[model samples]
Target: MKARSKSKSKSSILFILCVIAIFSLAFTGFKGFKIAGWEIKSIGEAITKGLDLQGGVSVLMEIQEDDVPSDVRQRTKQLLELRVNKIGVSETVVTEEGEKRIRVDIPGAYNSSEIVDGLSKTGNLEFKDSEGNIVLTGKDVKEATAVLDSTSSPVVSLELNEEGQTKFAEATANNIGKTISISMDDEVVSQPVVQNAITDGKAVINGMSSMEEATKLSGIISSGALPVTVKAVSVKNVGAQLGAEALPNAVKAGVIGISLVFIFMILYYRLPGLFASIALTLYITLVLIVFVEMKAALTLPGIAAFLLTIGMAVDANVLIFERIREELSIGIPIKSAIKKGFENAMSSIVDSNSTTFIAALILYFMGSGAVKGFAVTLMIGIILSLFTALIVTKILINLAVDMGLLKSLGQFRVKRGAENA
Candidate 1:
């Protein structure tokens, strides 16, 4: 029965070993593969890279008029961030530069004109009566589409929401046979006479000179408008060559750093150290998978946070191992020592990592751009570190002890006096 128990333990350990090997290769190995007609991309290729890592477009914009209110500027910044992100550029950084300037960095985007057009145009669609009083704004529009009229001419059709429908019904009813001006950013695009109240919440602007004009108007109307007028002051295209060089260097440094940690763990704690290293490997794989699946943008600061967390992870394991050593010194049996070690270390690990987790949350919420990137990575690392130390390392160490692979306290480098105890 004892032999059978040892055999079972050994098989479990072997299974763990296979998991480590397979996960390492599958996630960090060469590119990725296809399964059931779906291509699974490697973490390197699949993860979203930030502007500093992938390089793209940077545009500096400023309010066209002086003395813009803070709330207006803030609303403009928020709107720009949403607008660019909607265009499918992930991890775009839109930050306030100075009192008057705003900087936007979009990774993997190259079209300067499109970027400028999407951002600089206030797109504030307004309707006014012949006397020039504002009647409706872009906020009233539910949908905008570029379509052809019965005459087969390009036009923009607008659909108003419920509130807009009632408002428009009143406006048209009062202004029959009077011209209503449709303007974008105070530039009049069309003036159509309202012949009747005929408001089914739908209206069309007829004066689009071309299909492109109609399409552009429709898109801007649907995307919402900037609260303030802004113009691009400077536009620069970022090249990926620096990012191309930087990524490999960062990866190499991480590899070297982690490799050194593995060596130290193995040399110091012996069997437990070996098991800790495996747990560390699993920690990294799981973290990267989280990042990829979350579509989190990884930047230079994020990578630094990642490396910092690795040290934290090792620190956790070290604490647990020392506790185990202390337990063994008191003459506890191997399995009981391993279990007590973790139980004793649990409070310290949680206490230490929990503070860091709170700090990460604060930074993530209050900070922006790269600061946010760092906070996100740090937060992920702290959670994973705790998990690996409390659960993964404990399981592996207990398994080794049960399999009789760890036979003496000396394997954990406990003092020679305890080796015989």
Candidate 2:
């Protein structure tokens, strides 16, 4: 009996520590406490905002058909989308406007001219030696990555294909100690001196100011080339004034709705409801963390999806609590009742959440813009809700019971009587 008591005491301490850790992580994400002298942004600030929330540049381009096939136009559009996404722009929209025109919408971009210049360029990478002789092209490149050099300076490392290996080896051998100019769209992006003949197809371009510049160059080089040239026929600047006005109202509604949910859970299920509320708080924090980590863009529809998942999170707790009540009404012991409750609730919870996840997956693949954002956020929220409801809530309730804080079925609003037995 003494050993059992000691074990229970240890379990109680462990439970308390887990709760504290959860709260600390949640608080850090929500309030963003600083360490040392560096400032960390809160989860809200870390998440990328959509075009509707933050204004950016939109451009419509006409694909010039100088003997270019229709398939080339489509390929060009796809390549442009890849390039834009590579630049770290979240929730950017690239859609075919017509048979020959493509539309590009980039969020969080303030400079229209800079974006236009980047998007309009063909991004064809080439290496030229002195006397203006072309040594290698992007097609000969196998891969490109940004890395830190020996001095901790940013540089782009390149891997060339078989043909490129031969050509580069010959070029470097013939032009040792000479400068080779690397050009993108016929403009010199980098010039590096050839130290030796590179026979292994591996090379590095140094002298980048920052990692950002090196990464940009690497991404452009790795994205391949557009099959056809695109000319920007129209450019428009989108303003975020309307979205800014709507943000406060959206936040107010969300807060009010979630407050009502908390109150309902606490009042309806009593003890179990309180535990569920805490788990739901953790759920919200986890979802936001996922959004930030994924670099997902949050739009108006995405916010709606997040709110809807809160209700689903509560629903999961309600199901489990109802099962526990049923078991208690049958005069089962509290510990056995909790175990049976989760066991009975598992099938229903899995079925519902699985179906919802499937729907979200389909929407994500087929939808565009705001609809895609909504689907992505909904899927993430649903997964996190399941984790908190099924795992976190059960752990907390069991810990409370094991600690002797909850001993009677009466605490869960179930009376133990002869009739129940």
Best by TM-score: 1
Report every candidate's CA lDDT.
0.84, 0.83
The total number of steric clashes, by the backbone 3 Å criterion, in model 2 comes to 0
Q: Kindly state the number of residue pairs that clash in model 1.
A: 0
User: Can you list the residue pairs that collide in candidate 2?
Assistant: none
Candidate 2 achieves a global lDDT of 0.83
- After superposition, which runs of candidate 2 have C-alpha atoms over 4 Å from their true positions? 58-103, 109-225, 229-237, 416-421
Residue 380's lDDT in candidate 2:
91
Candidate 2 local lDDT, 1-421, one digit each (tens): 8986987898799779878888888889988878798887898778877666677777888888756677887788888887776656656778675467887878764567756666777879989998789999999999999999988999999999899999999999999999899988988878988888889998887778888778777777888877778889998887877667666777788889999999999897787788888898899889988888887777789989999999999989989998988988877888888899999999999899999999999888776556777998899999999999999999999988877766777678887622221
Number of clashes recorded per candidate: 0, 0
In model 1, what lDDT does residue 375 have? 95
State TM-scores per candidate: 0.74, 0.68
